[model samples]
Target: MTASTHWLATAAAQSVLERGGNAFDAAVAGGFVLHIVEPHLNGPGGDMVALISPGGVDPSVLMGQGPAPAGASIDHFRAEGLQSVPGAGALAAAVPGAVDAWLMLLEDHGTWELTDVLEYALHYAETGHALGAQAAAVIGTMGQHFSEHWHSSAAQWMPNGQIPHEGDMIKNPPYAEVLRRLIAAGFDGGTRQRRIRLAREEWKSGFVAQSAVAFARTSHRHSSGSDHRGVLDMGDFANFSASYEEPQSINFRGTTIVKAGFWSQGPVLLQALAILDHFDDEHLDPSTAPGAHTILETLKLAMADRDAYYGDSASPRALRQLLEPEYAHGRAAEIEPTASREFRPGRIPGLKPFFPILTADPGESSVLGAGEPTVKISGETRGDTCHIDVVDRHGNMVSATPSGGWLQSSPTIPPLGFALGTRLQMTWLDPDSPSALRPGTRPRTTLSPTLLMKDGFATAALGTPGGDQQDQWQLLYLLRTIVGGYNPQQAIDAPMFHTSALAGSFWPREFHPAGVVMENRVSPDVLADLRDRGHEISIVDGWSLGRLSTVIRDPASGSMGAAANPRGNQGYAGGR
Candidate 1:
């Protein structure tokens, strides 16, 4: 079974599964295909997080998030007269890690050759894939900037000085050649493992690095409307490698919910669960007013902690304390029938929380070019990023979220045929911040994927594609399926809501006091109840909030199921 954000990627993954490939192989194929077909959402120069659980083995994290470039420093950025990293441009790029991470997963757990796994992407890039409406719209929105400022991107996206319409055939021969070269690098008659290793080396030290660095050296237009050269160099690429790490797990309603560590925002979901666990199931039902209020308040607390404490340099003791049962009970006690509009991170002895400088008011105009790359602030739906989940007959399961490099993120590196990701925007310029701009330290990433286990076997894998809302949307699915007794499809189809009360993870770090974005499918009475409780409500269209995908396997019964979001008319689910 396979489920993904795009139908073509889903088809590609399921094709691999039908051809005797395992879950890992199918995921790799689908991921590469997403990079081709969903260029407006993700690209080869980005980051990914995968939770992999082999048959009978404990789940582990494939840590593909790259660190800041060696020359990326708070002093340098301040010297450049910037308070925050630009949301778009080479100046905000980390070492590109998504391609290397996918290749690493393929090398470690896949049964197919490197060329075989990447063939799907190559085919789409060399030939052509029909562009989706969302991609076309994004191109149209960025058309002015591309034509007037980023000419390289204009040449790549606009053919003959025209934006392609939806359903237009789009081809990327340069990216196809890039894939072909990586495949060629491995064809030295060596062992399969050695061949894959050679390809990895070539990616970090070869043309991919060279082309990206050469393009970044030139001053370019940034989100700040200033032209500046980037800090990335060849050594930054050569020093990074994707590796696997132990996953953190917490028991939730008889299921072991597993996630990545503190470096990512995965733990916020677990922390929210712990707080919700202090209440009865009635308060956990998202469909009811009281339940929704409780969930919102719980998320606010968790997210406040995320802004204060989560980063590559976070203290482990503080993280453990945040998940403690007594601590959760104490936090839950702060929730009231009326909403609390304060940014309240819990107090831990010897720890002083870092409060960010918030610049945007919900009542005022937002700063231009400050929106996260994953989703549009003015759109009906939270979009960008690409998620895939796969579960095979053998009990192996994987869930991955790939995002960051978007067509609108930075100037297109003409030779490489992709833009560098602006992930460094997640970091703060303040030296006191745990997620401060520091050389060789990862910016706290929003990419999160989850796995569920029951009785020591993998049962499900799930993920979605909203920047900060990624975990919030997934939390709704988890609550509905685990506590409300809804099936995977039912849970995914339910109305969703997320709070923007915490400091924004993207550039400019805006926050709204007591703000909530909810789908209108939620009962009108519930919406009114929330508004009456002092929550600032922004109601959107029905079925326009989340884009989640999941695949489940019953370890006890050997039965399998898959589900995908219906919001975008893009996500698809399939099984044999």
Candidate 2:
């Protein structure tokens, strides 16, 4: 069974499963197709993180997130006349890790050959695939910038100087050729594993690295309205590789919730769950005013700590203390019927918290279109990210969020047929900050995927692609499934809400004190009640907020099910 943000990608995963491949192989195949179909959301030159549970083994995180380049330092960015990293440009790129990471997973846990997986992606990239409406619209919005500033991007996306209309046949022969070359490089190997390893080396030390490094040396227009050369080099790409890590999880109710470590925002979900666990079941139902208020308030507190403490730093015992039951009870007790508008991070007994200067009014301080890529020309709307969740018949499961490196985020590398990701913009400039920009440090990324288990068996795999709202949306789905007794589809169909009370992870770091954006699916009376409780409310269209997808396995019956968000027309889920 497979659930993903794109129907084509989901079909690809289903096809892989029918071909006797495990969940890992199906996920890798689906992920590659996602890069082609969801170009506006993800691409080949991006990064991804996955949670994989092989049958009869402990689940682990496939850490595909790349770190800052060896030369990417705060001093260098400041010297470039920048207060923060640009949202879209070569200067904001980190080492591309998605390709290597996907290949690593296939070699280690998958049964298919490298060529078998590449075949699906190759067919779509070489032959023409129908252009997605959202992708086309995004390209149309950035048409002017591409034509004037990024000629390489113009040549690829806007052929003949015109953006392709939706449903038009869009082909990426150049990207196909790149994949073919990598496949060819692996043919002269001893074993399947060796061949995959050869492909990885070629990606790091061969033409891929050379082209990326050469392109970074040239000046390009950035979100700051200035041109700057990138800090990346061949050595940076060569030195980086994806590896497996133990997942951090906590037992909630009877189910265990697993997520990536502090490097990503995955842990924030766990922290929020800990706080909400103290509330009664009635107060946790998202459909009601009290339920929504309690969840939103808890999210704000967890997000405050996220901004203050979560990162890739070593020996941070503060995280352990924050997740303690005693601490969670104390934090939950602070919530009142009225909303709290202040940015309050919990202080651990022996640890001093680092708080950056907060923007009182984000509207006045934010630069227009300065952070992550947005779909609309105005840049007010958040851009979409890609997610894939698969559970095979063998009970193996995987959930991955593959994002960053959208074509609109940077000038397309002519040879590679894609752009470098601007994920480095997530890092802060302050030395004391946990997510401070430093050479060889992983950025505190917002791309988070989730896995749930029960009695040592994988129960569910779920995730979405809404920058800071990823885990927030997932939290609602989980509460509905675990507490409210809703099925996967029912849980996803329910109204979703998220708070902007804490600083955003993207550039220009926007925040709104006690602000909440909820779908109008909630009752008018509930909305009025929330407003009366001092929560600032902004009502959006009924299905405009979350894009969550999930695949679940019934431990007792051994039956599997999958469901995707109906909010956007693109997401799909199918299995038998």
Provide backbone clash counts, one per model: 0, 0
> Compared with the true structure, what per-residue lDDT tens digits does model 1 show for residues 1-576?
999999999999999999999999999999999998999889999889999999935899999899999999999999989878888888899999999999999989999998888889999999999999988888888888899888999999999999999999999988999999999999993878778888999999999999999998799888877888999999999999999988877898999999999889999999999999989989999999999999999999999998888899887766778888888999999999999998899987777888877644533112223345454333344246899999998999999999878888888999889989989999989889989989999999999999999989999999999999999999999999999999999999999889888888876566887889888788999999999999988887887888999999988788999999998799999998
Model 1 collision count: 0
Off by over 4 Å in 2: 314-316, 363-370, 374-380
CA shift of 489, model 2, Å: 0.2
Runs of candidate 1 with Cα error greater than 4 angstroms are 362-371, 376-382
lDDT of each: 0.88, 0.87
lDDT of 2 by residue, 155-218 (tens): 9999899999999999998889889999999898989999999999999999988998898779
